[model samples]
Target: MELLVKSIALKSPLYTSVHLIIILASAILGFLAYKRNPNNPNNRSFLMLNLSLAVFVAVTYLSNLDLLSISTQIFINRLTFSIGFILVIVFFNFCLIFPEKETKKSFVYQLLIIACLGLAAFAAFFDWMAVEKVVSGLVTFRPRYPGIFRLFFYVYALFAFWGIGILYQKIRKLKGKERTRVQYVFLATLLYIIYIFSTNLIPAYFGRRFFIGHTALGAIVFVGLISYAVIKHRLMDIKLVLLRSLAYLTMLGSLAGAFIFFVYYLKVYYQQFVDPDIVFVLASFIAAFGFQPLRRLAEKTTDNLFFRSNYDFNEALSKLSAVLNHGVVVSKLTDDLLGELKAILKAQNGLFILSKDENKFLYCLAKNSKSVTIEELEREEDIIKLREAGLEVVVNIPDDDKCYGVLALGPKQSGESYSTRDLRLLEIIAPQITMAIKTAKSQEELIEKVIEERQRINQDAHDRIYNRLGAMAKLSEAAAAQSKDKELFEQLDSGLRQTVVDLQKIVNKDTATIKTNGKLASSLKKICQQHQKDYNQAVKYSFKASNMLNLDDMAWDIECILQECLNNAGKHSGAKKIRVNLAQNNGNLVLEVADNGKGIHNLDISNLPQEHLGINGIIDRVAKFQGIVDINSNNDGTKILVSIPLG
Candidate 1:
């Protein structure tokens, strides 16, 4: 108990320096982790671990200074031990959430937390029940430690190993830079825990009386490694280490400079009459008094120098507007805007994702993301991976009442902080980008609607037109039956058949622009099927395409010629059967038609286009294609041949 009031000069120089350094480093890491994303549980737990260590170190340092009475020391020691228990739980919590947030509301997570809180509650009372004694000028261990002490140690070790196992699995599951980050954090934790065993628990196990109450100070290793990971691998992100550390370090340097300047000025004025203690006090006073204001100035100055100096808001807006106005080409606009933003912000890596639903996402682009996942937007043990791969800011692209998606920005190439100004620029751009996404989504919906409407219209036209035509054909047959005139029946049948064929051509051509698999043969096959269905008579046609016809419009012209020839054959050649031969040979297409029917009298092959309407149509079509025609007539059948040059 008397050691509590022992001389302050007995404080070890090494212990003082180590504790101070740990506090500073821990404060920096913890603060940055919290500042970057306050809503993140992973970061919150990280912050809690660091804060507990810093407070414990601070209290231990003050305990050595005789700044508290014996009772106060007892209470503070127990409270610090409680914090230590909490620290262990926080570290485990951090491990469970690495890369992203884990579901802490689960039964296992909640049970562990409750167990730690229970240990923490008992740690404050049972920890200092031993008779007052000291080891290494501090109460680090008792000769025979109480049950609560062993309990705290066991819980700490259990959680540490469990946390390490969690990190190990994550490192194995992840790849590339993500794997590297988890490995760094894992190595850092394993080292720190090993450090704790060596410096705090190992000595006690061997019954060493003089203990080193430096476990809190030894956390420098953990903090140092984590800081390295943040800067190099973007564990929580690079800006977490870069922005605040630089600004505060500048402030610290300014304070140090003022202290030195004051010290020298006081020494000069009071050379002979100098009291060293008074001089020290006065300089420290000036530096301490100037601390807050100097810190503010230094932070602002550092921000301007490192990031704000080169940033021009107007230029950024102009470039963003240029990208947005590039056009509604969805893919082009998305890729172009991502490139533009990445360049403008100078980000080291980036992810741009727009999800429409659980299964369907709008678009995804990476500015060298190292292969981040869709689930990794808020990276986790199993949630995502990019949170460790330099992700810094996630801005929601919002329009009206809906949020289309987020634009996740990675750490800057310059490792500068993503300031509010940069965020404001993103905010302005998000709405316009949302408009582009909406346009693309609307286009897809419009295409679906057009297809459905076209199908409906085609079905209606087919039903109504086919019904009316069928009724007309029935009436024509009925009239022919009553009049008993064979010539009139033939004329009516011919006119009706020709009208139906022309109408079918117009309606089918307009309603369905079928490509038929990029081949003319497929279209001709469809025409043959329709001819049989329309006239109820078969036209045996054989087609052998020797080469790919380079002509595109030739498909339609050839189809028309076949339709006219078939019509003429079916109408006048009533002797039962007709056959068509279409063959391509040596850059020329030859078509032959023959039917067993009554022959035409004095048919002119060269000037047949001037004869019957159907025959004239066929002759005209053949002549325009630069082809020759030959016709032969006999009592049994008639044969017509046509040839057209391809080149």
Candidate 2:
């Protein structure tokens, strides 16, 4: 009863008010991020970090208040101490899995968390510092604790440094703007941790605990950087980050109004302060001249943060222009355009559907669908499928030259409605997009025609020359059988036959020569049979690939390699039997050919023996696809291995 009377007589300190504001602000920022995406582990851990900070500040401040009784004050102190360590541990956990990277907790990390939890629990139950009926009130000097409490300084330092190292590793792994934005977050977190350590732990060790109210202010840097990252770079989510700042502002406005209501309107503490009439005149003057511009500036600042830095129209235009200027492939250009636009607008998805089926294709960044046809993309919300696919704004890719298909963009990532500005930006870039599609298609068609024409001319020459060569070879063979000098005629026939084989290989240079619907197995088997008949030796062809190679040039290149290998082995290896195997291994198409004969004693793939000229051709062909060639040969036998990447 005496204690309650004494507490009532003691005036309420202003530090408690400042502490409450800080704690509230920190909590609001945390919950905002968590609520935006609770499923995201980054968001989940960030919430814990913020809540721990709030609790740390709250208890630390409340423990220093004179109104609390000795027992209550001591309990708050223990909790504050526990929360202090918990904050650092939580921060360390955050560092492990931030910016959307999944981390498997190592045994050492798990042990650290367990150790921190144990220490926190011990601190809560049993005082690390020697204390008896005392509270570290702001003005009242706290009693000197024992040396054991000082050891925790090392613990805090260890966790802080550990977090820095983990954060550094994670940041190093990132590239481009992502690394820069995360560095902001890293710097922010580092400052917060270091600030708390400098202000709280060091001061407490010296038995002069100051800056209890400032603990809340320390995390403001972190909160600001987090908001900056989100707003400027759209870090976690734009809506989540900006709303917190806006909410803080709204909260401050309400607090100011309430404070004015009590102190001025209700006159509770108004009597002792400056005169009301003079204050009212000054308040009116400030509101008239200052409030409108201040409000406008705040509004303008947020708009600039979202649009000017993040979703820049000029930058998007420049990017689209660069893509249009440099791109020769329609497929690649479409992909780059969609990706750039989606990122710039902070959009959920984007799509480009080319019309007429004349080098026409459909591309999208949407998850619901990977495909969309010209029929399905009619300006595009009119199409039920497109609306269902989450396309919110669809722009017609039409101009005087051609009526290209629609370019549709989904809703903003923040779930905000698209403005006229967004639609206009897309509108302006639509022509460049259309031209890019048209120009790429024209170039592709021209190149295809050129390839077709070249193949036609080559076929004409090959047919006439090959027939003449065949006739000459048959005549030579007849002369070899009839004439007295048979060896010379037989040698001429063999050379003619080799020339025919080389000519046939020249025709097989392009995939257009083989109309096997991109099937390697059937074509390879057929070619192997023909080669077996020519060489008059047992030849085996095995095809065992699961994933299809999508690269257009891969099939022809592989065939060329196989032909070169077979020809080299047949002519040079003097092999009786040849075994060819093709299979998929580790995302690569593995092709191996083995000849059971006297080996060529080849040492290097690039620098083969003088006689292995065809092997050099095989290596050159394989180099186009960025594939690997390994020739393992000795006195027993020779084996040629080719591994090409499969899409």
Candidate 3:
């Protein structure tokens, strides 16, 4: 009696547990597939495929839950089987769209998939494919009622093979990471298909009751391979996912092993006093409610024992990330990073060096070290030699087009090579370091540009406005000397008023007519029309609805720039017709102003003097927004193009 009870409890739940695990794993992968990138077509297709597989596993799991009523079990079985059956078509549909490839399958394939779905629906409604009666209030599969079970499986096989073949063809045409991703799916599909054939179909064909029916256990490998491809190749974050999976499995397996031992000892010690049935019930009760608390305890204990240092590493990086996100200045960022690296690597000294030109380390922040020289570390070979001499060195650029930096950590206090665990911690935070450096450089450049622009604006005021004021003083002295002459005095007064008006125009070129409702196009059009209507110049402009702009001061800068160009066209270029074009191109707002008039020669904007307020003002305004300006002038006309990032 004890042996029989043990065999039933262990063997039955074990197979159910395997299916449940696969179901949980597949569901997790499906959730991650969408969460990683909801907009990616490949992610969507992968999610659908995982959903189908999860449903299939869940249907298998439901077959072993003995607590449900017979009617409910029968209903659930039918519903889940129908879903699983339909998902076969879903899987094939996924294959047609996998890896972001949109290859349309043939007409025959579409018809076959629809026919398979219809047949599955028919089987689910009628008692043809699977029919069973309630026995002892428990539903169980009996014999088929003259249904096309073999035909259904055959159709499923046909679609699955066709999909796999399509995937293989797609794989053959791809290269690099794309080919690698498809290879993972193709291998998993091939392995699962072989397992199904060898374990379920071949044995049933030979008239055998095989235990290999639950070989869906191989789904663990399938989901694992797909997850690895996503994490290692696609760069989806699998850190928490992997940790939780490991922790949960470790806890569950440990508790299960403990329970098996508990059951064996209880049977030995209590079977004579209590009924074996009572002992089994007690064990089941313990397994039900005790698993969750036990898992939490085990997870805590495991973290303390094995992952304590990793916890510290992650915590440190998180704090450092917070500092980077805040408005930490570049000079302070280097110092903070140096301190963190020293603490994390447990090294006696650390160095943070940046190279604007990538030719030499011009900026250095070293903590507790003077042995290193910038000249020695400038060469790649020298850095390699240092890395060979038990020092860990990492070199990276903040962005692809900019300066690069290097981090070198001296030997640890314990004088041992850095562990793989330590290296992994460093690798995980390397990109964050690069991003922080990028932020620092951006902040520095903005400040520098602001200073340069201020100097240029001051110089413009000195040359154009202040110098005119000095001449006005001299003219006033001459007018005072000729006070008796009424005509000269009247002319001087009129000239002074006109000079005041011109100075007001230069200072107030950036009008406060900008909209707060993000209607940049309307404002631009208003400016264009005002110029045409007020000055009677033919000004034409074009814009699209998708070119909507809403940047604080950015749109204003662009407005001022366009206005300046139009003013130059109307007042100086002697142009009659001006064409203005505005559009959004690849995350940038682009504006082009073209005029049909006598063109100005030597139109290099960089060569424009401070006194040339028209072109100088345009350059200064664009520089403040990190914008680009190009001027082309010839005998035809002058065309000015300006581009500013929409952000």
Top TM-score: which candidate number? 1
Cα misplacement distance, residue 10 of candidate 2 (Å): 8.8
Q: Can you write out model 3's per-residue Cα lDDT over 1-647, one digit (the tens) per residue?
A: 55334433655666766777788777777766566446556557767878888877666455544556555455555555466467668778887887654566799877887788787787567564233455544455532642365665577677778889988998999997678778888888788877766765455445443223364677777877766665444412233344455668787897788789888998998878988888878888988888888766665654444332433756877876776676347778877776767777677776666653432432232222222321123334454456554454443433444435656676666433343345545655656777887788798899898886566456444434454455456556776898687755664565467447545644664323434477788788987885674345899999864745676566655766776777678667789899999888888878999999889887667787767876777787778778899988998999999987766
Candidate 1 least-lDDT 10 residues: 359-368
RMSD (Å) per prediction: 17.6, 18.5, 19.1
lDDT of 2 at 324: 80
TM-score for candidate 2, residues paired by index: 0.43
Quality of model 1 by C-alpha lDDT? 0.66
Stretches of model 1 off by over 4 angstroms after superposition = 1-14, 63-76, 104-109, 127-148, 210-212, 238-245, 248-647
TM-scores for all predictions:
0.44, 0.43, 0.41
Q: Candidate 2: deviation at residue 578, Å?
A: 58
Clashes of 1: 4
Residue 21's lDDT within candidate 3 is 74
What is the number of backbone collisions in each predicted candidate, taken in the order shown?
4, 0, 0
Worst 10 residues of 2 by lDDT: 359-368
Error of 1 at 83 (Å): 2.2
